[model samples]
Target: MDWDKLRIFHAVAEAGSLTHAGDQLHLSQSAVSRQIRALEESLDTTLFRRHARGLILTEQGELLFEATRSMARRLETTAARIRDSEDEVFGDLRVTTTMGFGALWLAPRLPRLFERYPNLRLELMLEERIVDLPMREADLAIRMKEPSQADLIRRRIMEVRIRLYASRTYVEREGLPRTVEDLVSRRLIVQNPASPQVRAGGEFVQPLVAQANSTLTVNTYFGILQGVIHGVGIGSLPDYITAGFPDLVQVLPGLESAAIPVYLAYVQELRHNKRVCAFRDFVLEEITAHLRTIAPASE
Candidate 1:
């Protein structure tokens, strides 16, 4: 029940080694071990399984760790909220989105964010998995589909399509695929079936992979973009990326998947958090500005 003991336990669980946790806490290993033992005795439950290499969480430890993780996130959110000023947006804001959008769209525009809010500490989590917004796995998320998570404020950003693209050089070298039938003779670059991807993208890529004579599978959209840019082959890519990457040309112009909506979401408790508001505003503004430049050409 002691806050200090919970903090120490959280640190040790995260580090997976008493000595490492002690190093972080600036306490001797013996002192850290004693505290852990005392805490376990108080709880009357073993929290960790001792091993030669390091400790592993027991069932009870896992439950406690989850609780502590939530506690830590809530504390951080509270601290950030308290630190926020109407005049300045400064503090940590963890943002999650798919790897493709993070690497292809968001990452490049981040410099403007830093320029405006120099004190902001931004953590960009680029993965396909949905981070828990209410649980504070991340402060905000830009996702390909509407988030079903409760207790969140959600905004629909825009629609995107998965379509084939190839470099001009590749098209020149291999000739453009006039139809899905034409794709049979050319190498298809796609996200690997094993990798998590948006449903639209998976649908667009699956048929290409099945019909192509040769195929190259990359684990992420970033890798697929690299392959397409380097003249590797035609690829299944998000239509949004074409706005940033000028060299990529849409292949088989008639072919693309149904529109998928992009959404930005945050916990309702963060409604007044300056950092989250700033980021949300910046993203909405950027989308508006870029769509103007991209629309005429994209159409």
Candidate 2:
């Protein structure tokens, strides 16, 4: 019922220790303990079970924590919207994308963003999990497929295909695979089965990896790219990478996977946010530049 008490309870529940929660709330441990006791009295329910290790949430506590967490997320979203100045593209901008694309493509081009808006603070979340943009888990997302989540504005940024590639030196030394069958005699480098990747990439890699006599499997595309660059073996890599690593020769070019659509998405609420607009435009400009650079090679 009391917002202040609810806030304190949420912090304590999250930290699982009164002392730790006190450190975060800038209150004394005894004061935090008193607040928890008062909250329990008001609710007439034990929220936590004490143990030697730490505090564990009771069933009622879990329910209350979930509600409080949702409240926190909503408050954060509101605060972000309020901080978005009409004329200035500044403040925190959280962007989520796959590890490979974030590290390989977006990270390299971020300097241009900072040069334009030095006051902007960017948080890059590179992982495979699809964060909830509408719920404000992340401000924006660059995903391998279109986001099906409602109340979000999404734009198809580009398409990518998983194709076989190897360094020029490796292609010259071992020769290119004339057919998929030829891979049986050569080592193949690929993303491990457990790695989180687009369905197209996974499908393209399995058959080639199956036929190889020797194989090196890495969890991330960045690792697979490294292996290919060092001549470890032929690798299944996204075609976008070729723009940056032009010397990497395509192998069995005819054998490639279906196109994976890449989408840039954000909550509809952020449509007018200057920071969001600036970032969206920046990404489109970069993608256009990349396409132009690779046009001659493709032709």
Candidate 3:
């Protein structure tokens, strides 16, 4: 149970090769191998199975690796906490959100954040998959719905609705659909029904997709937005995007999906982190500004 041996074993298990692990740890391959052997002798267990490709963890090694991974995350959390004890809002902050929102909304406003905190290192993970904040997968998350996870500090940011939109050129050529029934003959551009999306959005588009004469389905809303903007067809897009795209006209203005609530969340452990607080405040301020900008038009 030597801490140094455990550290080496964790690195080797992660790399799956003695030489690669040695390179990462700044130790010679032979030295790393010797340490591994000594650790195995002390534990009286074979931790890995060597093959032509590399080392594969034995069942016992897998269990040990899990523990080490948890330890590593805890150490990182501790380090982050210590760093945050300073008054400066500067350090690595990992934020996760859906690709569409990250690309379409948050990414565009990031310059303002950097202008305020030049030393802040931000890692934006844009993916459909939800990461585990409690496990330290990410420092923060902006999700389409309230998070169900325990020990999370979550706040509803805003509500978005899925509504039909078309570029000016497309509307000029094909004309607007006056009724739900009028949509039957028009080409529809939408997010693929099977893609990871909010339930309200998928439900709103399902009947439209079935009734359309032709369809273009993209997995991401950013792609769907592009298709709609370039005159591909009328598309179902979140209402939040319309302010950024003034040229997009509403199609069937009365028809809209149920509201999808957006939430910002982080683990309770990050409650006092200045970096997290700064980013959260920035997002809230942006949202308030966005709502105000769109208010006059909506009214």
lDDT (10s digit) by residue, model 3, range 1-299? 89999999999999999999999999999999999999999989999999989999999999999999999999998788676655567779999999989999999999999999998999999998989999999999999988998999999999998999999999889888889988888889999878899999999999988888899999999999999999999999998887799999999876899989999999998897889999999999999999999888667
Give the alpha carbon lDDT tens digit for every residue of 1-299 in model 2: 98999999999999999999999999999999999999999999999999997999999999999999999999998798677656567779999999999999999999999998898999999999999998899999999999999999999999888888999999889988888889899888888899788888888888777777899999998998999999998888888876789779988867889999999999999998888899999999999998888777667
Candidate 1 regions exceeding 4 Å error are 1-84
Q: What local distance difference test score does each model get?
A: 0.90, 0.91, 0.93
**Candidates by lDDT, descending order:** 3, 2, 1
Q: Give the alpha carbon lDDT tens digit for every residue of 106-212 in model 1.
A: 99999999999998999999988998898899999999989999999999998888889999888788888788898899888898998887778788778778878
Off by over 4 Å in 3: 1-87
| Per-prediction TM-score | 0.71, 0.71, 0.72
Total clashes for model 2:
0
Clashing pairs in 2: none
